[model samples]
Target chain A: MGERTIIPFGPQHPVLPEPLHLDLILEDEKVVGAVPSIGFVHRGLEKLVEKRDFNEMIYVIERICGICSFIHSQGYAQTIEGLMGVEIPARVKYLRTIWGELSRIHSHLLWLGLMADAYGFESLFMHCWRVREKILDIFEETTGGRVIFSVCKVGGLWKDIDNETLKRIVTVLKDVEKETKKMADVFTRDYTVQKRTRGVGVITYQEAIDLGAVGPTLRGSGVVQDMRTLGYAAYGDLVFEPIVEKDGDCYARTIVRVREISQSFDLIYQAINKIPDGEIDVKVKGNPNGEFLTRLEQPRGQVVYYAKGNGTKYLDRFRVRTPTFANIPPLLKMLPGADLADVPVLALSIDPCISCTER
Target chain B: MSYMPKSPWLVHYDASSCNGCDIEVLACLTPLYDVERFGILNIGNPKHADIFVVTGSVNEQNKSVIKNIYDQMPNPKVVVAVGACASSGGVFRECYNVQGGVDNVIPVDVYVPGCAARPEAIIDGVVQALGVLEGKYKNMVKVAK
Candidate 1:
């Protein structure tokens, strides 16, 4: 081995949209180990439960990660609703699933764009984001906010999507799926993309499970675990299978996400077709007096939320175990023996959301 | 002041942002918004950047980080604090780890407000930063005499 050297990759880096500082110990061009540090974006949001009432805390939680904002609020509301034994109406569940799926699609597309950019495919990155903009337009039109959507309230959603708008959403999704397919082809078949991603960051199935990997990282290792399968919201009423790939390399992870986008699209279409007309919300009574833990599938992976209520408007304690936190170990496993030049691609493979991980 | 030799070079740093503003900041560089049309290029190095765009509130760990980036930037540099978090710490203002807005660390030339500032507003902030850059340029030239 050549003389060992240290290279710091981020807290600020062009390839990463979020802050994830890693100290890579390298021998010549190959990384031998990595020391990771987070908390740069930690706003101590969990502690804000004491200041904001449980009702308003959904807003705080939604800000955990902008790309996954809707799902954060959805998970928060669902957890609190569980703590209070509040059973939401069927329509509310369906609406939450729809919006949640939209979050997944846009988030996955954003990752795809970032990955393509990491491969130095600028045109692909631009096109991927161009398609994603339509989803953002859908969000702005329906939710009135693009990034930090505060649509989820404790009892139910703030507004109901009209049937006309729902139908239009279906048509819009059809176009999005068509365009996503083109980009998916490039991600899968392109020479440079394959050169950069495939076989680059390999984690075996046993290693992924042992490392506590979640989301695409675990699924890419051929693990068939997805929190959606737990039947939360409309997932119980809907029929779909989790996408899994066996290679557990960067390519497998990318394929898992690409396939999941189409799955989420189909799930949305399925929900719209089966959505029953009913009251959007129900009367919620009394403060929560118990503790509850919930697991939900975020685009990145399964997120765990634990909430404790003390018979008041405010929660006693609130905590989240974001997927990035779980995936970081697996990321560390992949770093050693990697070429320094492939560090960015390896980092992006985990779809690290340091903001959510820290919050 | 009449014409700049080139469009401004921008360096974006996420101080303590939730990434809402950071994503929108990136959205500004993408196809629809395409800040590149105005000749703005997003660069990674602080020393080469003329405009420093920061998102989120200042926190304990990133406070020194924000200052280091600002100090590395050449004189006559412009800092645009994007989103409500960077402007005045917004909702996370009361968080224990957070120290408040970006201005608490570096001088801010523009402040864009939004829970997560919209791309339209972010692009507008960049345009506004350009004007401030030109003004600073003029002041630096005056000092040279």
Candidate 2:
């Protein structure tokens, strides 16, 4: 080792969306080892379930990560509904799926922009987010909130979309799909993007499983594990395969998100077309007496929520195991052999949502 | 306008946010909102930043970090606290680690309020911060005189 030096990567960095610090041990421009230090964005949200009632806790849980805010509420709503033995209407199920898929598309687009920025593609980053503005517009029109949408509640939704508006969203999404295709083509087919990403952070198929990776990180490594296959919401009725890449490098992971965006659009179309006309929610009578665990797919990976309610308004405990937490070990695995210059891109390939991880 | 030398360079720090306001802050930079037209530049180093934009509430661990970034910023600097969490610890105030609001640690010049402050609100806050920055510059000049 040619005079090893430990350099702190960040709690604050330009390329990173959230504060994720890593102490990278470098030897002659190559990263010899890396240790991640998180919690810069931690707000201790899970404990708030004790202070907030089960009905009200969805608001707090939803703030765990703004990118996946609706999905968190959806997962909480589903788990509590499970605990209370409440079955929502088919329409609500389909609506949740639609929103969740929209969320996925938005999130992946945001990641694509951030990843482009990471690799020093400024114009591409701007273009990607410009296309993303359309997605945000849809969110504002439907959910009423641009970022942290509080549309989801226990048992069902707080608001319902009219069939006409739902149809409008489909057309709007088609335009978004075209714009996204233009940008995603640059991501996949571009020479510089491939040069920066390909073989930079290679994780083998077996190593991915051994390190407990999830979402695109796992799927990118040739594993066909997607929590959507479990089908908690309207995903059961939807048909799509997990987009897998055998290369297991940064490029593979980026391509996985790009392909998933198209898949999300297709899923949303199916949900809106098959949506049933009925009451969105059922009446939830009492608080949950038992614990329930539910898994949901986020843009990054699988998020597992465990809630233990004590039959009171308040819950005994709430736990959110976000995908970034699971992806960190695999990140460390990727870092050792990488050039120190590639650290940011490699760290970003997992799309580290530090707030989600820390929360 | 005369007092201002160049467009303000910003240093943003996330103390203890949910990444809600953070993304909105970023949204301000992207092509649609495009704060760069106003000559605002987002930079990493605290020392070079003229406007220190903080998202999220003050927490025990990051209190020193906030202070360090604040201290490093030269005089005539303005602190814009974006989002409810940074303003008054919107939801996570009662949490053990949080101290509630950026003001608890550093003096805030602008408070942009929202659960996750919208980009428009964030831009408005920056515009407000520019005024605060000019006033501070005037004061610095007076002090020198």
Candidate 3:
């Protein structure tokens, strides 16, 4: 039934850096469907929670999405410390799990250098952003803002990483894990990156859990799920695990973000060798009167953060569901019939930030 | 070196940002702030650009595709803009379909303030838009004499 045409693709193309738009529906170079249209870069920011309050709304939910800005202020400071119960200590949950696994290894090496500059492989996207500028120089040497790291705070962590800066952030994450394993072996054994991501856009594990896919596109379809092993904060005494990959395509979501950036450098070297020294924050006194619902694992997936405090200091809603808005209906169900030159690497293999899906 | 025109090209335009200054303006053409070693490339058409750059801000569905890609470049072109929500609409400047920065719609020379502007300040705002693209090509060859 090949007789259709509509192309669009983005709120600005060139392998889209953000503002999404999709549309597609072609038939010539194949792709028979894809609607997608997000609010350009919506900054209603949960309507700035009725004018910033629950402690300055964690800098407006960490600017919503500057590459998962410190896990959207650590899931809105762990849902305003689980609605004002506030117990943040154990060195602020090992410094927000070592700055949330170093902002999930700089948002999975900035989505593997924007999916190697969206397939054209411009010098493997400049060696995957020169190993992501040493993870943005370990996030501007422990959060002074290299990308909205207002250092997560709602009951904990404004800044604190001593022990010689956690031994120079484990010697700059072992030289950013040896330059991200030589750029994840040229993106998992290159051959023009497995001929533009093997089996381009497959999605199956029951269509990624009946299309409600989350994180690593539902752990690259094997579905082992991972809101950081659902342990929250210090990942319930560390030792995490979730990098699955059953080849749901786009080369198993780029091998589950290159093995979760070497499992976020062994969970930031077991959170800097069992970090435990005490008080990073915990002085909250009021406001934040209930209703929580948090969730984290960001670097592109599983980010729900609903909060509805109604006990003053501006009590009200602050919703934020962003994993590119639950992976855009599984990225429009992996863009039908595929090949409109694999629609910008299947819309950048579900890493479409779209200002965290219209903040 | 000889009236500098050694590859300026550029044309990145994401009019309603938050892809953190469009991934630091594609991290200034990678290789650890290469800025294509001053030949600056980063192209994707805008009538074969000259140096438009832009990042984000000026919304309402991308302000007429940012003035139709700054009127399809190819002039003594030079824009820049970059970050802090493309200089002004920084934090999505009071939302509701922002209409703030990128000089409220166009005409910016080189703003590049940060909020996501680094990559060595977008290669010093593309080397200050290569000195405003060599003074708008010496005022368009003095209005073609």
Candidate 4:
């Protein structure tokens, strides 16, 4: 450990799904410091909201990133709806919860598969992805697209889910839960995965909170704070608790996600079972007139949406505090003092989505 | 003598993408439509890869890294451009940072088309790459045998 070596991990790496460049300062293959440079995928999405109308901005927000598209749109819509004093129908609230949780399942499964790939476990990667396809098929069946499901509208949802479709979704979710449990068992017990992930990136509960870490990353550190606990959307109707761990290691993060996927399954089932029958959306008679700040728990973490409308078709301003962006500081902290081999897995444990961060 | 199928390890590079396409690329390996059945594994190190899946349009900053990765991959490699941006610069075509499609920098073997391509399409593209791999392997076997 005489001289330090600096390695630029990626704005483009095979295992990572986003454009995040991490400069790792290594001392004899042990990381000493990590600096993250983002903004590779920034498309000025927040700025675009100023140009697009409040209604059209929903589409723009959905395009923020494909994996977290639904959450961004939902966060944006919730902010606007809050400002306008619009009460969404009960069925729509339940539908939003169902979709939100489904999106979480898909996202967590996606992350699990990528984590497996990063650790050189090709079989586990394949197994996780096979289950993810069922989720995507459900998305295609209910919404229109697989990735960017622009289904959530400002006032309500763009489309209504029928009882038959709801039943089918429930049936599919049951199968997904069974398969997800199998994968989770394997992921937790498998020697190679354990070797690669367990205790690799350990962040203390205090460090996680101080660094502004949210979602599973924070929960993995033994923090029980989840925006869903605030009871937005139909989460109020559902009875579930946030999944937490005390270890704050890569494995703990993995467990948090795996358990969260199961929780998402339950939430979706409950939403589907308790879904009411009513109009999906309400008509907005006038342009928005005030500023609203709203928060929602995305698959990654808590996403804050701030929107200001000046009683015009076009919004005055729109801003989003994405989870990946919030978690970066903590992620950087987790990288140092780890083996070079564990860099990718450690970075991925936070589930950094560069597009979301840069947006 | 029977020949073993070449397991083409993949190296994914995001030149200048918005990450929508990148997520879908990752989805190709998740439980939904696992590409690993065909031996498509994501390798972080470029030297170990047999295929380069370049997402996003080529940009000034990442162009050299893309070329370096393309050149570093062992012989008998294929490049699959996995989005409209990578294939034709889709929505970000005219941006100052974008240098058109990925083909502007590297020779792409297969093009998966979509705003952010679905995982199914990405798996299909990798399957198509196997055809290219088979052809290259046959050429190698003829030289050896």
Please list, in the order the candidates appear, how each scores on TM-score for chain B only. Answer: 0.95, 0.96, 0.35, 0.90
What is the C-alpha local distance difference test score of each model? 0.92, 0.90, 0.80, 0.82
lDDT of 3 by residue, A1-359 (tens): 77899988767677876667878889889887888776667768687678667777787677776777777887888888888888888878878888878778888887887788788887777777777777777778777667777887888887888888788778878977987898888888978789988988888899888878888988898989887777887887888678888989988888889998898889888878888887788788978887989877787878788888889988588888877677788778778888888788888888877777776
Interface RMSD of 2: 1.1
Output the better candidate (2/4) by lDDT. 2
Top candidate on DockQ is 1
The Cα error of candidate 4 at residue B56, in Å, is 2.3
- lDDT string for model 3 (B86-113, tens) is 8898665776667788887789889988
Q: Which is the leading candidate under lDDT? A: 1
Per-residue C-alpha lDDT of model 4 across residues A155-243, encoded as one tens digit per residue: 99988889998888787778878889899998889887888887788889899989989989999999999999889999998999889
How far in Å is the alpha carbon of A277 misplaced in model 1? Answer: 0.8
What docking tier does model 3 reach? incorrect
lDDT score for residue A38 of model 4 = 60
Cα RMSD (Å) per model? 0.9, 1.0, 20.8, 3.8
Please compute DockQ, using alpha carbons, for every candidate against the native two-chain complex.
Answer: 0.88, 0.78, 0.23, 0.36
Sort order, DockQ high to low:
1, 2, 4, 3
Candidate 4: lDDT of A129? 77
Instruction: Show the colliding residue pairs in model 2.
Output: none
Question: Residue A148: error of model 2 in Å?
Answer: 0.7
